[model samples]
Target chain A: MDTKAYIASGILELYVAGQLSEKENLEVAEYAETYPEIKKEISEIEAAVLALSEAAAPNKPLSFEAVKNRVELSEDTKLIPLNRGRNRWLPYVGWAASAALLAGLGYFYNQNNQLRSDIKLAETEIQALEEQIAGASDSLEKTTALLQTLRDKNVTVIPLGGQVAAPEAYAKAYWNETEKQLFIDAQGLPEPPDGMDYQVWSLTLNPLTPTSVGLLENFQTDENGVFALSNPNQSQAFGITLEPAGGSESPNLEQLYVLGTVSS
Target chain B: MQLEELVERFKQKDLRAFEQLYAMYARNICGAINTIVRDEVLAEEICQDVFVKVWEKSDAYNSSKGRFFTWVLNIARNAAIDELRSKSHKNQKLNLSADYFVGILERADDEPNGNVNTDRIIGFIKNLKQKCIELIDLIYFKGYSQKEVSESLDIPLGTVKTRNRNCISQLREHMKQN
Candidate 1:
């Protein structure tokens, strides 16, 4: 089974918290004995909990005598001393040594479990941090690419001022005439209403004609709010109009949100 | 001696073994009781009773069931909650606040209160998220089950374990920082 995934699932923490069911408790104990890493994790989680609960202890220490006096010891049991003969002493010695050996084994098992878990935690932490670094580097590369495109000499940056339909709205168009590609920075435009979309049009001002380019779909959810469309037409100006979900064959002049003339 | 050995000796009615285990967990058990009872002197009294009960019921504990700490923790909390419920008719009705151990931290340092480990406790929980604090209190202190925690916190059932793991992870980071 995926022991690492099981460890990461947080079940061990609940096990230490004693929140798991009877079956789950037995399963965890079994896992702890079988998997050193799980055992180590259970130990650390137990320790963290122990520390928090310990810290909540009242300022005054509870007298050991207080607890000692209240607890009744078994009167029948008595400790046998080693002052007697060798034969009598040998069994006691044997039991003591076996107990000692058992204790030693338990101690080493605990230590080994602890070390393995420490290494596992360190590895998981390092993995999380590496993922973060990779994510940051990925975003940095994309930003750098966007910066290069904006600085390209062949691209014309046309500032599209807000139109009367929505005076506060604005957008920018980066027209690469040679490549016939238009990049729109629609960051300044408000979100299109439900079931509506913003459509871009390439216009030839001489006859007041406009050809629909593309609709900015998924505008609200898009992180950058930038749309790129191919505009192969020999256009004199550009305008954006809001229309029903899909782009219209002809631009709706009244719904024009922004317009800008391209200077030749 | 290893914890298993100590616990073995404890189960065999060895006073020294009981003393060792008591010393290891007395404050923690008492603190846990205090979270429920909300009174230091009363909590101490209940804490002592809990230890005595631990001795009487030593044979019931098994490694397979749970950790020794967790076993005793259940005893301590149950005793405290019983004490609170029994006194429900008193003039000062006991309300087991959900805040748990944070009460000691928020109390003034000069007040006549159980302030011994408040500083360390504050350091341990410093900068922890509020949700983490509540989760720890509910599960660790109040002994809520996974389903109960999900319902009380209004989060998805599957989220409780993973979310709790992350919270405790943050808590461990706080401990390291201190």
Candidate 2:
């Protein structure tokens, strides 16, 4: 490419006038990009033309803002303040200070949140431990009162051996005559089947009469494995049987788990 | 090429970049329109609309097409010509013989300090031949294509670019001196 010859061709003038086709315009742009001298020539030509056009403009032409207002293509942005810094690097220094301040504020904000969450976690753990302690002390107090009742001298203890239904089961009955309360210690008893309860019976010797004692309700939840029932019928002997949820009309003798005699 | 960068950003709808471009070309575009329309107020009106149209049609412009000024100049010329075709412009023609824009500088001499742009611009064309003035007005201000200029001026088709080049060179020489 003879750059001087291309510059002398005057094709660049028409290019500035936009008289060329698309292909010619692209070719001119390519040459301008590649050749500095050609680009300079084009700029000079453009300046001369620009001057003529500017002279022909209205004496009181509208301001740039006025022309800008006629369009809504994101031209409504607020004017950014131009830098009024004294030194060349003042803006860079200001920006650095701002960024550092923002980072410091962010760090402290995160630290404050972390401390607050730690304090909350400690408070929650303390509350849960306090509830557990209250529950344990309440259970211990109930078990201690039951232990004291077992030692009362007016209460007679009867050992009941497992019947044919469960030969391995055993229990003790503490019969308090004054209180009419019979405490059954059923540590050796197997859990009752689903939808069933353990019913106690007070028996008479000759006629084999059976009187109802209260069922062991909530047998599954008794952690101490001991139950008490009211027995006022002068029970001669005692038997434990697995009956349906409500006590039966008579003991299902086939399911009797324990039998004991009340010693004189 | 900061101007190139600005034009690229302007095409991407960057309002700030477009502001720079509007400042750069708005006056020249209005002046060009005034030459065609020969009414300062009406030319300013058309010039405002032309920039808005330029923004709306920015996608139609890119570095690949031609000079950004040329694109804008083409738009202003069309808009000004369109206004002239309207019935209202028929009555507003200041001089039916005003075939060139140098008359603008002559008209500006009557104004006070507002004559600064035309004053300096008048110096550039002070030594220009009448043919130079007509060619400049037709090619740069009127956006006449090479073929259109040749046919209108009755010149051979091949001579338009060289003749335009001579006229613009004289403009550059005057611009350098002033």
Candidate 3:
């Protein structure tokens, strides 16, 4: 009945160390739940042990990525039993042959249906393969086009570093002065909040006049986080701001994420 | 405890939850393994494998059985022991010295920046008795049962529990003073 005596008995330490039997552990767990002080004492014991063991660690903890990959791989291995289950069907055919002649015809008919289903499965698998090949080609073409745009000599590369709101935010403006087109690499930018899109701007210094280039629409669907927009302004600098989905008529100076001056 | 919630999430195969638990206990688990295997590289490898096994066998864990740290600590010890008994370790004939956790701190003057918190553990170990270190190492680090500890330390069966109590009280006191 005395909590102090219970705490001093040191059973709680053994309980935390898992030295107690199942019955003893359950009793301790019950007592801990019944008495808050018991629970606190248990935690303190655990904390002390944890500190001692942690100090013996030889190196920093390994990242969880390795653990995750191995665990997921084992998870995937479970699905493989489905195919192994199919192989058992072949052994059944041999047994059916020895069982009786009358059963042979029925077994053949069943095997015919199984073969038909297998053919259907193979056809669907081929369709999946075709779709994958088509998807890969589509991405390859897009990558080639993106590379061409990046390599174009006329394009001016403006590095827009992160702003105060999002310190990690980054974007690049690849402007083609002759074509009046700008490609904005907003890879470093986080996704705009719902109903918000990042809008680009062309700024002229001295008077500090700002002109809207274009809004980066369908930001989510745009792969590679690169958007191409028309910019037809003689500007000394470029800036990007977050605006409503439809975009604002002017750049919101307060939301300006990245800004860079055009160096002649 | 909030850790119970994290353990529940871990049982549900939440990787983020698993990561949170790992960060909390990895050092302790790895340290325990290192204490047994006495090989930093091998202990690290086994420590990682223990976590992966824990993830695969998460269904085997819950509060009713024991503390999550206790469960993990057992796994780490068993894994490190297995490594010690394996052929490679046998050929090496590792002496498997009786160096307890405090020994790491005692030897820290030689390697000041060893992965361990030399300053903090030194402060803790400075006032700790040799008996306290040995008892904690046996029951806590080595995963020895009370009966085993009693036999190994030649202490009376009745005294093991209370003796460990006093020893841990000293540790808690040291922690408080620091």
TM-score of each: 0.54, 0.54, 0.56
lDDT of 1 by residue, B1-178 (tens): 9998999989988989999999999988998887777778898999999998998889888876689999999999899878877885355564343455677545524454545455655766757888888888888988888888888888898899999999998888777676
Best by TM-score: 3
Q: Model 2 segments beyond 4 Å from truth?
A: A73-264, B90-98, B112-117
Candidate 3 deviant stretches above 4 angstroms: A80-264, B91-97, B114-118
Order of candidate numbers by DockQ, starting with the best: 2, 3, 1
Candidate 1 off by > 4 Å: A73-264, B89-97, B108-118
Query: What lDDT tens digits, residue by residue, belong to model 3 across residues A170-238?
Result: 889999988888999988888999999998999999999899888888888987888998888897999
Global lDDT of each candidate: 0.84, 0.84, 0.84
The pairs that clash in candidate 2 are A56-B31, A57-B31
lDDT of 2 by residue, A1-264 (tens): 999888878899988888888899999999999999999999999888888878877666457777566565334332322333335578898999999999999999999999999999999999999998987887787788888888888999999999899999999998998899899988889989999989999999888999889898888888888888888988889999999998799999999999999999
Q: Give the per-residue Cα lDDT of candidate 3 at A175.
A: 90
How are the candidates ranked when ordered by TM-score, highest leading? 3, 2, 1
Error of 3 at A197 (Å): 99
lDDT of 1 by residue, A1-264 (tens): 799999899988888888877788888888888989888888888888888887667777688897887774323222323333566678999999999999999999999999999999999999999998998888778767776776789889888999999999999999888888888999999999999899999999989889988989899887677788999988888999999997788888899999999998
